[model samples]
Structures are given as structure tokens and as C-alpha cells.
Target: MTEHRPHSATTAMGNRHDYLPAAGRDALLPTYDLLTRTLGVPRVHQRLIDQADLRDDHKILEVGCGTGNLTIMARRSRPAAEVTGADPDPRALSRAERKAHGLPGIRFDRAYGQELPYGDGEFDRALSSLMLHHLDDDVKAPMAAEILRVLRPGGRLHLVDVGGPMTPADGPAARLTLRGHHVAGNLGDNIPRLLREAGFDCTEVATQRHRAMGRVTYYRATRPD
Candidate 1:
């Protein structure tokens, strides 16, 4: 079994603004796409996409789509599926929209993960990548519930985020990198339990370690049919 580690931190009470400065934000827009494409980190997202067994007719929703990298990938992977990417950052949404321009059947919206602006059971699959760590339990727990709420009865939720290695001591820098984000520094520990509490059965938990900086953890859960 994978070891779980929890860290303590103060949760943000209300909607928080992006920490990146304007210039930094602008720079990140293009850099994000380049890095994800070059390093194949987005493959983590791809794994989730593949696990969902997304069909051309499936309606998919991506929460916290950084810059449409995964959104575009999903659209291309499932040409017949209607894909929508939502983010709380307006700048990120703009970048996503620009990246997706001229792409039919794909759209981007400005929204929060904790409070998605969509109807219940509206999508066949709901996904999030590298976004949950930015949220606290106050946000993440509810966000998981919201993801389950928006997914169809038999739909699945795929989450990709930073987590510990097979053991906490296996990777030290991962904890530091997460601390740098000032979000859920070490919250991956609660994911499974949280999913259970949110009314979903976590079907799988997979992990991939990066040199020393961090490891990626992916969770696939399903709403009861």
C-alpha cells in the first residue's frame, strides 16, 4: 500500500487571486504549453484521459485547464466529444481560448473548481490535472463532491496532481516543491478518504516519480451506476 502523509496549513477562505504577477502570468501562458509538450508531463493527463475510455460521443469537462493543453489534446483524441475547459484565472482562460481558437467542439470558461458552473450529471467524464494541490481541504473535499455531482451516474473522475513517492522518504524535494506552491502542501494523503466521503469509489491510484523534484499521482474514481 502507498503511504499517506498529511501536512497542516491555513485554508483560504474565499476565492483567491492568482499569485503570478502580470508579467509572470503572461510569460507562463506560452511556457506552459512548451514545457508540457516537450517534457511529456501532460502524459499524466493523457493517462487519465485514456483510463476514462473517453468515446467520441462522450461529453467531457476539464477543471483548472492551465492553458488548454489537455483540453486540446482531449478534443483531438475524441473528435466527436464536446469538450469544455474551465479555470478560475481569467488570464489562463484567455490563453486557453486563444490556444483553442478555430477548433470546433471545444470551449473555455472562467470558473472555480469548488463551484463549477454546470448542471448535475451533465458530463460523461470530469477531469482535473495539477490543480487539486492548489486547494485546501475546505476547497478540495467540496470540489471532489462537485466533480462527482457533475458527472453522469456511471461517469468517471480522473485527477492528476503532485504526491509523495511510494514512501515519504523516497522523495524529499516533492514535499518542498509542494510547499513552494503554498497550497495543499501535502494533501495527497487525504485524497482516497475524501473521495470515499464524496460518494465515489476510488478505483485506482497510480504514481510516477520525477528525478527528485516530485512525483505525479493519478486517481480514477467512478460514481455509482
Candidate 2:
């Protein structure tokens, strides 16, 4: 059953993308953070890190470290580990770098998921939260291959994004609002098989949630030795 509330206002422009296209990233950063909090991002990031299982010596990379929330968390969790956050957005990267000040082994750089700046087998684990869906259908496989290429044999890629449809219980308004978001696209595609074809061995998948996002999925895939 839908949680009872005053009917969601402005249900027509229900998602951040609608706002983003009009006002741009500078205006929407806080809005983005607010929605992330609504979806319980701290809890989400915690679970994501737990699933990552970082080793003491692990060299980790976050492919789309947008506001650096997860990147910061990963660095804090393993102070000795080398945690690097690379993103294509200069504005976001600058903000993340500032927020990550004084953290040893945490660096931010401008880079895209498709053509990462790192050399092969340099990292023990890679993370991409809510980022894969940005790539077009033809690009996603190559992006996955790029991620696989940067990791060492057996290196793990920990990811989370939208999944299949919402449960039958989900309200129509909820579904309509999320239509253009990353989750919807993922649910419609054969992501695991794409990863497998990209040379990753799909390890695990499970349904999880964010406060703002109704239904998302977690995935773990590793580069085979």
C-alpha cells in the first residue's frame, strides 16, 4: 500500500532530471543531496561498502564519484587503503576534492567511465553507484569492458542501480516519476549478460532500496584470473 501522504505535489515534473535540464547542476547539487538523503544514502553507502569487503591493501576506485559521498566513506572505512575517485564532471570533482580535504590516499580526478585514465590491473576493486545507466545501449558494454580492463584479475566491481519494475504495490505516481531515471533503463536490459560478455564473471545480484528510489539492484562481478 502507498504510504499515505498529501498527494505528491507537481507530480508532472516528478524527478530530478526534469529539474536538472532546466536549472543545471550548480543549482541542483543540494537538491540532489536532499533526494539522496531521502533515499537514505548513508545507509545505502554503508551497505555498498560492506558488500565491497575492502582489504587492508586494496587500491580502490570509484568511477563516478559525484558528490564524493561514497568515495569519502570508502576512504574513511579503510584509512590505509588507496581510494581514488574519478569523474568526468569538473564541478562535481572540485566539490568532492574540497570535501575530501586532509584525507590521505583519497584523490579526485576528471575521467569518464568509458575511458578511465588508469592502467590495467591497478585496482583491487571498482565501484559505480547509480552511474552505469548514463551510457547508451551500445556504450554500456564497452563501459563495462573498460571497468573490467582497469582491474586486476579477480578484482571486483561493486555496483548498484535501478532494477526491474516496481512491485505491483508501487503507486502509479511513483512509477511515472521515476520513468527517465537510471533504474528503468537497467531493468529493461540484460546487464548481467553484457557484463559476462565484457569478460566479467557475474557473482551476485540482489534487490535493494533507496528512500527516494523505489527499487534498485546491487551487483557484484569480478574479473576472472
Candidate 3:
């Protein structure tokens, strides 16, 4: 299910960056939801939402929110919360916007995780699901720092991504896709290490066995008060 659908974008400073599409390919974009659902991402999304402990008036941000599945779910789970999902993929954002057309208190933005378009301390809570591993190694820390900057003091970040030591139960594809250089270093304790380097006090909260994603670890990273 791992697709290396790479795309390019230029920042205001004229720096070019690459990003992977939601489905790894433009042709697979339409079926992104189907693939995610088949992989039990919705269930993982709910767990992340539950951990977020959303409240009324909370400004929630989801980074790399492909197609808005988790955004829509958070909006539905906490109607009073204003939810925003940011991603670099326009086609995926379009689909997300359409899927959330009738939903109030929710919106999608065309932006990258590392270069969020929002103001400092603009959000009370942030969520990321299976999106961290999609980033390039060099982009990881900056994205973490960006998340820290956009969150109010004491705000919490709920994140889930591929991680941990590999096991025999993991399939070959999962091992191959997740063990890539860009991905391998981002796994396991390195996640917390990355967040901590960005000034967040992070702790591993839970872990799950993904059918095709190897071990998935959940972490709660808190911006200091």
C-alpha cells in the first residue's frame, strides 16, 4: 500500500521541496480512503482523537491530513471544536474539502507540515496519524518544530506512525517500505528523540501492530507551559 507518489512545491523563499501524495500516485488518489479503511486507519484515527481529549472551543490542527478522514472524524467527535487539516496535496485537499463540504467548524488548507501557514500558538491541540513517516528525514525536525511553534504553551500533540524494532511477524513489503532510509531513522525511540529535540516533553503512550505497516507507535508530545 506504500506508494512513492512524489510531488514538488516551492516556498515563498523559492526553495523547492518534495512530498508524497496521499495515495502515492495521482491515479490512486480516489481510492486513498478505501486503502486507509482497509488498513484500519479509521480505528487508529479514533484512538488518536480519544487521546486528544478535545474540548469545546479548541482549535485543532491535523498535519498531513490526507483527504480529511481524521479531520472529519474529529469534527464529528467534537462539534464545538474548530478543526483544520493541512497538507501539500491539492488534489487530496480538494477531495477532503468536498467530503467535508456540509460540515461546519472544519476546514482544509493547502500547506506542508513543515511550513504551516498558521500563526504562532494558533492551535490548542494537534493530531497526526500515519503521516510522520511520509516526511523526508531532514524535514522531520523542522516539522516537529513547526508543530511546537503553532501550539499554545502546554498544548499536546497526538501522533501515530510506523516505528519499533522489526519482528518476524512483519511481512516483507512492510519491512521493505518502512525500513527505507528516510523512514528507518524516524521509527521507534527516535520519534520521541525528535520531539524532545524540538523542546517537547514526549512519551510513548501506546503501540499497535499494523497489518502491512509493521509496528505502529503512538506518542503524546507536550509543548511546555
lDDT of 3 by residue, 30-145 (tens): 88999998888888899988888999889999999889999999999988999999887888999999999989999888877877888999999999998876666677888899
Candidate number with greatest lDDT: 3
User: For model 1, where is the 10-residue window of minimal lDDT?
Assistant: 1-10
lDDT of 2 by residue, 1-225 (tens): 012111121112333321111113456665666667776767777888999999769999998788788999998999899998976556676778888888889898776666677899999999988766555555576678889999999999998875545542455534654667444557734567778899998854666543356666778999999
Residue pairs with backbone atoms closer than 3 Å in model 2 (clashes): 39-211, 39-212, 162-183
Count of clashing pairs, candidate 2? 3
Model 1 lDDT, full chain set: 0.71
lDDT of 1 at 67: 75
lDDT to native, each model: 0.71, 0.72, 0.83
Residues 54-154, model 1: lDDT tens digits: 89998999987867778888999998899999766667677778878888999887666667788899999988877776665566676788899999898
Candidate 3: pairs in clash = 5-24
Measure candidate 1: CA RMSD. Answer: 6.9
